[model samples]
Target: MSEPREITYAQAVREALRQAMQRDPQVFLLGEDIGVYGGAFGVTDGLLDEFGSERVRDTPLSEAVIAGTAIGAAVTGMRPVAEIQFMDFITLAMEQLVLQAAKMRYMFGGKARVPMVLRTPAGSGTGAAAQHSESLEAWFVHVPGLKVVMPSTPYDAKGLLLAAIADDNPVIFIEHKLLYKTKGFVPEEYYTLPLATSEIKRKGKDLTLIATSVLVARALEAATQLAQEGIEIEIIDPRTLKPLDTAAMIQSVCKTGKALVVHEAPMTGGFGGEIVAQLCASEAFDFLDAPIRRLAGLDVPIPYNRELEKRAVPQVADIVREARALVRGEY
Candidate 1:
């Protein structure tokens, strides 16, 4: 087997789209500024030239239309990968996504399939402010039919994306805006990672830290710092949020006897709460030496000021502090 190659998260996603389109003629892309303009973040850059205008389409500035069109194509036996400019904009198409795309398969009694992928950039870092930088993944995870995926590294970004496109259900594939240029080792070959599986990125026996999206990277950094102080933190990244890998998480928490859930989303109504609740209700509850804690973003609009924005979300130091408190029985 060949060695894995290093590439940016954005490049990995582009490669997945290219390979999927090449392998299946039924696969096509449609979204605002996705064609000649190469998408808002350039993830779809250069595809228009290779696949032509018919396949790499540029649609109107209507999120509802883009989502509606993708659903229509998917039900008609076409694989449509639609892009929402930013996650915040997805609210405009919630009716189409939550009501139509999510309920199609069940409403049709498994006779219909919506093999479509809705890719959107989420989270805040580049100062896009409140309207452009929301991480509302919990909303989709609440829906029954939609599958939610938030891949952190370049490897999972490509692999999980391929799996999402191949699934016979509507997938909400969320990409973090700050992670676009982050580099990591990714296989050059076409590969797919299981959707509902969680990955233990780092192994430890001291404490279990379950982080999602951009927080995964931050948690790893904090782990490095804590390791120097003789505190080993086992980090688990739940790449797929909807169908969480609860068994894996339960096992980790049981072994460590302490757990901390982290995310960039607001603390109130965040996905972290679900993770904590799952741990509390599971057999892991008996094994817990401390209360399952959540370290998440402040429940406020993402600030425009740089420092304020930084304070809004959990930083590396914040993770380290929280982990120390949990391990030392200070929480």
Candidate 2:
């Protein structure tokens, strides 16, 4: 096969938005600091120049306003892509997201739809402090009618964002801030993949490691290091968290007979707990040779101190150690 096109994570997302915006007249962007500032991470850079301020309109520093406005625009026939500066700030717009966008269709007898994309950056690695660095995808995933997505690689970021924009339901598109500078293969042309699908990034028969966003990269790295130690690790990235690809999960666990769920969220009440429960509840539990393992963030606010912050969340070495333990049936 031919070589895949390489692109940065930020550029991959920009290409998705640019292509979708260029292809569909109804698609537009509205958020804070997007027009003149080029976005917090420059993901929307040059978009205003090409699409103009009319479509790439800037709004106040209010997540509620951005969210509510996008929902209204969507219901009225416009496809609006809203950007929340930080995922932690999403709480400001929770009412609009949960009450308005998520419930509008079900409450309205399925006659109306909230077709919008909420793009926000989450997780810590850039010394962004507590409030600026939070992985809050679990909060939204619990709500029905809202699609939650977290793409780990550059290719998935571009493909999933394109798929999200085309989705009929409201989608929470989360990007890990630390992954913006990372590069990978991205097709130059526009493409769309299903929102609720999971990807098997690496194939193995010894163990299954399911991760999201930044954790996917860390898991893959750990798998490479583990390879030298005579251990095989199968890695799965559930690009969409809400409609989690449980079938892929079951298949992986059935093959490996062991599973590990890792994320950047706090250990208490995080989504990993739910994932483990689901795997155990399914028929796949019978195939397991060892118990499932979860390695997540600590139950505390993210620290501003760089050294403390690094330890707050799961790291590469930690995943390697955890994976080793799980395979050894010691975790």
Candidate 3:
């Protein structure tokens, strides 16, 4: 094992892409401004010079074409990693992703595979307005064929991304805009983490906090604050949204007897709803001492004003307040 070094989340993603592309000659990248411009958030920076334009490709400002091209390449035996500048633009490429890439393998009776990755930055905090700052993972999860992954830390960001690239299916890899520059320790050697595994980040006996992406960090912060007041929260990060590790979540809920799902996506149709529904259907529902509450983004378009945007999503204080109430049976 190599010594771990601190690196930003964006750096970890770049390292994963570099390692994957180097290890597989068939793997190539295509996206708008990803070549010399180095990506919208600089996650793909410097790759064009290292691998040249052939592998590190730059396309015109057309997400539909970028996605369609990747799907075609994947079906033809190429592992193309495409980037949608922001998740908001994915709507333009929905046909290619939902209709084609997601159904190719089953449609062709396992004779064809779409081993492609669609990486995009999501979530608010940079005040990029409603269009650019939406947490739309639930949209992909609703589709039967796509694998949804949201990595909160640099370590998981690197490992899970490598796994997504290797999988012979379309993977919707979401990176929170605020998490990109956040630093964490990452091993120098290449590694892969299971895409279906959910990790219990912090163990507690009182309540369970299931969080995704940027909310994971906020939940952990809230956990620290609540610890001082005697409220113990077990934090579970479903690193992979689809193919979710329901067993891990169920076990945590069974032990704690209360659960609260937190995410930046709106409450009405967020991924948290699916988690709650699964828990309700499972035997974990019997173990609950109180209702499983969800602390999520407001059911409205994300606001462009910094203060209003912050209000739209769950915050550290919101988690602390909600956890306190849930544990006390006040919610």
Query: All candidates' lDDT scores?
Result: 0.95, 0.92, 0.95
lDDT of 3: 0.95
Predicted structure with the largest lDDT when compared to the true one: 1
Residues 173-210 of candidate 1 have per-residue lDDT tens digits of 99999999999999899999999999999999999999
Which runs of model 2 end up more than 4 angstroms from their true locations? Answer: 1-3
Query: The CA-based lDDT of model 2 is what?
Result: 0.92
TM-score of 1: 0.99
When summed lDDT is taken over every stretch of 10 residues in candidate 1, the lowest stretch is: 242-251
Which residue pairs in candidate 2 collide? Answer: none
**Candidate 1: how many backbone clashes?**
0
lDDT winner between candidates 2 and 3: 3
**219-272: candidate 3 lDDT, tens digit per residue:** 999999999999999999999998898998999999999999999999998899
Could you tell me every candidate's TM-score relative to the true structure?
A: 0.99, 0.98, 0.99
Q: State each candidate's clash count.
A: 0, 0, 0
> Which ranges in model 1 have alpha carbons more than 4 Å from their true place?
none
